[model samples]
Target chain A: MLRIEGLTAEVDGKPILKGIDLEVPAGEVHAIMGPNGSGKSTLSYVLAGREGYEVTGGSATLNGVDLLGMEPEERAAAGVFLAFQYPVELPGVGNANFLRTALNAIRRGKGESELDAMQFLKLARARLKELQMSEDMLKRGVNVGFSGGEKKRNEVLQMALLRPSLAILDETDSGLDIDALKIVADGVNALRAPDFSALVITHYQRLLDYIVPDKVHVLMQGRIVQTGGPELAKQLEASGYASVQAAA
Target chain B: MNTVVHSGAEGFLHRFEGLRARLPGQRLAWVQALREAAAEQFRVAGFPTRRVEAWKYTDLRPVSDAAFDEALTILGDGDTLPAPRGERRAVFVDGRFREELSQIEGASFAIGSLAEELPRLEGRLGALARPAEESLVALNTMLFEDGLLVTVPTGVAGGVLELCSLASRSERPSAFHPRHLIRLESGASLTIVEEASGPEDTRYLHNPVFEIELAEGAVLTHARIQREGVKGFQLGTVYARIEAGATYDNFTLNAGARLVRNEIHAVLAGPKSACHMNGAQLLRAGQHADTTTVLDHAAPDCASRQTYKTVLQGKSRGVFQGKIHVHQVAQRTDGYQMNQALLLSPDAEIDSKPQLEIYADDVKCSHGATVGALDADQLFYLRARGIPEAKARSILVEAFLQEAIEGVTDETARAALESAVAGWWEKEAA
Candidate 1:
């Protein structure tokens, strides 16, 4: 479960997420649709504890554990994952090795036995196949020389490997074609379960169609203006953010 | 003469006359001439000072003042060598070639001591190293004791040859100078792995030089790994010259010694020849490693590359100086040089100078130098996956060095160097 109450944050001393209040219970996928400057990414970064984002006020917690007080890695150890809109390129790190290291790191943090190279490779290959990513991508450097679609799928791949309880997909559907959108959606949909939850941040309803959400929240100007059933997405698509804001 | 007061270079000159009788090939005229000339050069340029452009970043005064003598030959029966991954291994204890300790695979081509083959190898000894302006190389030529002579006949693929220099346990601070000569005839090829190591507590100086000559169409791969004693000091140099259509590849890994300087000079003498000079240096506290290279492109259409990476931890210091010289006639020459350093600690320091002197307007040459700490973005990327900060830092450093290590074409050599890097990571983690 994820909860945010008046989670105000700032970047470069400029207020962004003024006062966001939201909750995503277990076994549900939530969609946050907003305009370009609605602080959607700012919210995700604050939750993930990325440096340079000052939490001005309010609190955010996962399962009653304070998330803002943790390091980026500590938050990850506490089952918080943020899939960046643009995955950072590691010039010389192999993708397979990165996956294994991340998996083992989380495993060790949780007091579980770490997976050896063989076990990690086996698990990675299976999940990569499901995401339609070639095994060659495993040999290449992480996110290096990768296409836009492959980069997004790699984010989903990490989500699969770490199996985080709260995955904040920041603009996961920003740069995908129809086919790439379907594959990425398939990867996310496959991970849908009672224990797994995601905050799919997007500006379009196309991705929401592929990975249908249980709750749709219209985020406008750093605040969630409206929260409704899945049909709220369709209504917003037909009219726009202006009409949605007026109605709210 | 008054200026040579208890200085390192003066110390060598003081013992030169008495040590001449113990020197190998003492009876040979050309060998004696070389010694006299080199000794004269060393005396003229005492120990290089900071004012010297080449020695600007490295100060040799601290450990250089210690008295050094010939290591007493004390071979321990319990001292075992790692399995010879090469076809033959010419092992040296202290500065003398050990017949019983060495492993010579077969009689393929002429392979023996320079002392025994002095008459035949006299003219070829310093032929490749024409420019001995580097005082250290000149010093090595003067006090040279014993080394190996590996010659590959035309068109013969000389299997991997490991030239090993092992310093036996010595009570007092001692020194050794080994002059290794490698000559590959036209169409011949060889892979050489040179390893230098010594006892942990034995304070010594190992000054080694490699003279390499590749004829037209010859290919030679030289991988040198220096894991000297922590209390030891090493001043190693490689001088290589390649002819038409020949290929020369040299890789070095510096992992030990309290102070070390691995210098390489490569010349492309003919058209269409290619040369690759690469190395990696890993240093911890109280350690200093420097790798300097000079690549000369004398003919057109020749290609040369130099990549050196250093990972400095604790209060260690690392330096890299690479210079590419494209001569007037070397049109169409392609030369690339890069030096990158990763400073793990705030006290760690790196000085990198990548230079290009292009006389040929038609040539293409590029040089790059970078001094940076572990990348924050890369660290966050790894740590965000639940990896601890220390582990993430190690992974990124390994990745940084592995990029240059991948340039080593020989698979086994790459693996050996990779494991060495991994071993460094483990030690740092501990």
Candidate 2:
């Protein structure tokens, strides 16, 4: 449902993602592994339509729609979600209120009726349970004093509520403990369906153990150099990205 | 003297003389003396101009240029003012106490008018409302028409005391000067909610002053919400004295008027006293708002915390000047202050100065000021979450002012403040 053809991007006038060609069809999970500064995060940002990231060359499409031409909110309404590497701390915006607003925005975009407070709360509570987050977290400000793991789990909770068609997890496992990693993976795994897809970006293969991917791609020097199956993840985990870099 | 262009000064002095002649029938000798002295001081200092250091950002030209006539008594025609959601209620109209319009329900304390009770507590009033070099205070004291006098007796507690000041104009260029004196005896606890409102579209000025005295071990929570008429102008001052082991918490919200200045001066007079002052200003269009405060630490181990937030849009202007003074004897004093402003339009302006003057060596004092527009990155983040740009901006703006509102100790008051903010957001969005 997602396609990128020779996508070249630049941030701050520096070329970051150069000629990245990839495709993720419906009902499949893809893992993009890369070293630091290999354009992993940049790719996620560009897909989610973050500002200041100039699209220099090529094109990206989602479900046969031009994604680059739309605003961030429009892209989100078109079912594009990015789990930020570092979630922002919104001091006074309640988590439940923010989530309800986002959920209704997306729903209205798709010609659906908006949920009221009660209905929103019921749906949010169920999603919170799935993500192993307490109900009190909904009362506090969005991610104000949440732990690293809780923040990641909150991101997963939002994804579950929004139910995006293509989810991009940008370094979601950077600060999670083993248990948190498992819970986050469980949340993602539960959302896996025939029509849903995700791009899991990480440096290690540990998160892959919980949410196994159908395709694994090695990204080095702003380009995807190699593509393989789940076994390639184990190979890279055992030998590190040195051999992958050498091969590239 | 030149009798040509000095007509305004002559009329002002004539009003002062008329007020002095009417004072004997209103109060005792000491009170009359105090008024006379204050009138002399006002004559000497006159009104502050833009050249004054403290009044630089605020120009009183429009107010001074207008011929201000002495407020005449126009009591409500038996229609009492709306009672705030509290037990005790006091109402003042045109700077005169309207006994028939006020209600003091429940047996918590003694509440009366300053004209009646000032004689008994003259010494305390003199000590608390000491005449300052400030011209505005002098003017308020000299021509003060009526005032509220409240005393929460020792060990008294429960329920909030509401003070409502209503100013309506039957004639053009009229002004009201309402003064208040509140004393919380030792071991007393109380909450005072002051509300200032006026007739819609009425062009008037409401100059109100409040002096609060807290004895040892006293605790008082005071919240002032100013939602006067858009054509009204307000210049209100609050002076509070905190004694040993006492605590004073104040919150001010200014959401109305063409020009409003709410000044607060809190004095930590004894050891182990604590004071917290927090507020927010929401200005739009041609509105101008200012929240200036000065915290004085006179004894050791005193603590003071202040936080002020301003959100300016269109051609609005906001000013926040917070100063903390720690004397030599105020060792181990802890003072923290922060002022932040969000400018939403190119014509919007905010002058924020957070200052600290410390003479004690062993003190922890910090001040910070930040002025900026909304974070583009955060705005994009919210927009990318499927939230509309307008709604996303409102959420961030609400978050920016949340810290100040949440500092309010009363839940109902906090909710009221949040609703006020939501109303402002709706207007801004439109």
Candidate 3:
């Protein structure tokens, strides 16, 4: 579960998220739809504890733990994952080594035994099989020289590996094709559980068709103006955000 | 009153004057004359100052004012030596070869202490070294007591040889100049893994000069792993002459020493000859490391490549100067050089200079330099994966150096270099 009350945030002295309140209870998926510069990405970044996005007057929490007071790594250890829109390219870091180190780091934070190299390789191979990815992806550098769809798939691969309780997909569907979008949606849908929740920030409603959301929130001008069921996404697909802006 | 400006070479000149009669190869007239000439040159030049273009970035105040002991105190035989990196090894304690500790007895090629093989090394010794032009070489030529001498005959494979130089712990700061000579005959191949280290708290000076010669169709791989004491000073110089169809591959890792410099000059003397100089330096907290390289394309169709990376943390400083020169007759010469540095802390500093002087218009030569801090986005990406900030930084640092480390072709040598870098990271994390 996640909660944000009066989440007023700014970037470089300019306000982005004015006053907002939103919550996603356990076992629910929420889709936040908005036009450009509507604070959709800003809300995601602020919740993920990224630098340069100052939460001026608001509080965000996960599992009743204050997320605003923790470092990014601490937040991650507290079961939060942010799938970047544009995945960073680590030129010399191998994908397997990066994943193993991250897994061990989170394990250590959770007071669990770390996995050995052999064990990690076995687990990673199985996950790659489920995702229908090549073993060669493990040998190559993380996100280096990968195509846009492959990058999205890599993000999903990371999400699958970390298995965070609360996942924030910040426009992960932007550069993905139809196939990759379906694979990504499947990857998310596969993790559906009583304790798993996700906040999907998207511009279009195409991705929602693959992984239907329990609730739809139309965020406009740093505020959530409307909330509805899964049918709201189909309505937005027919009528663009311009009508929603006028209504808002 | 007229005051004399200290050239910083006065103390070494004085030491040379006193030890000239007792130095190695003193009985040979040519060797004596060579030492005297080098001493005279060193006396005139003293130590290179910041005013000199070649020494512009590195200041020698720490080395000059150290006031090292006048004579080397040869430690006792019971001194503990670090483990050998390979089967055939040559150990040197404070610039003097420890034959008892060495294991090169059954080597097919000629391998022994330079002082013991002086009569056979008459014409070959100092052939590739330019003591007259380089002050550090002059210092080494004048005062070198004992060093490794390896010669592989024509068409022979010398395999891997380990050269370990361990500094003795002395209360008084001491200085040693070691002169290592390695020659590979035509069609011969050899690889040398050289390591220099000392106690973490010992304050000493390790000034070594290496002369390498590769004949036609020969291949020579040299990897220098320097992990000197944190309070020590290391200034190493290497001169290699690669002949036609030969290759000189050299990689150096500067992971320790309060002040250190690894300088290399490689000349491609024949068509199709190749040289690759790659290195990485890790400096932290009051440490200073410099890597300077000069690649000379003297013959047509020769190729040279160089890549140097430096990572600075705390208040450390790093410097890299690389130059590639192509002669008029060296048509179709291919030369490439890249130098990069990553500053871990705001106080860390890096100075990089890359130069190319080409006389042949038909040659392909390029050089580039980059200095930057860790990318914020990259750091956040790592930290966001649950890795602590310190661990994330070290991972990035290691990754940055992995590219240059891959250039080392020798497996054993590359492993040594990799472990040295890993050790540095472990110490930093601790």
Return whichever of 1 and 2 wins on DockQ.
Answer: 1
| Candidates' chain B TM-scores in the order shown | 0.95, 0.93, 0.96
Error of 3 at B260 (Å): 1.2
Candidate 1 docking category?
Answer: medium
TM-score of chain A of each: 0.97, 0.99, 0.98
C-alpha local distance difference test of each model: 0.86, 0.85, 0.89
Please rank every candidate by TM-score, starting with the best.
3, 1, 2
Minimal lDDT window, size 10, model 3 chain A? A239-248
The candidate that wins on DockQ is 3
Spell out the clash pairs found in candidate 3: none
Model 2 lDDT, residue A128, Cα: 86
What DockQ score does model 2 reach against the true complex?
A: 0.70
Worst 10 residues of 2 chain B by lDDT: B1-10
The residue-by-residue lDDT of candidate 3 on A156-203, one tens digit each, is: 898898888899999989988998899999999998899999999999
RMSD values for the candidates in order, in angstroms, are 2.4, 3.4, 1.9
lDDT string for model 1 (B234-293, tens) is 988888899999999999999999999998889999899999999999999999998989
Clash count (model 2, backbone only):
0
RMSD of 3: 1.9
Alpha carbon deviation, residue B7, candidate 1 (Å): 2.8
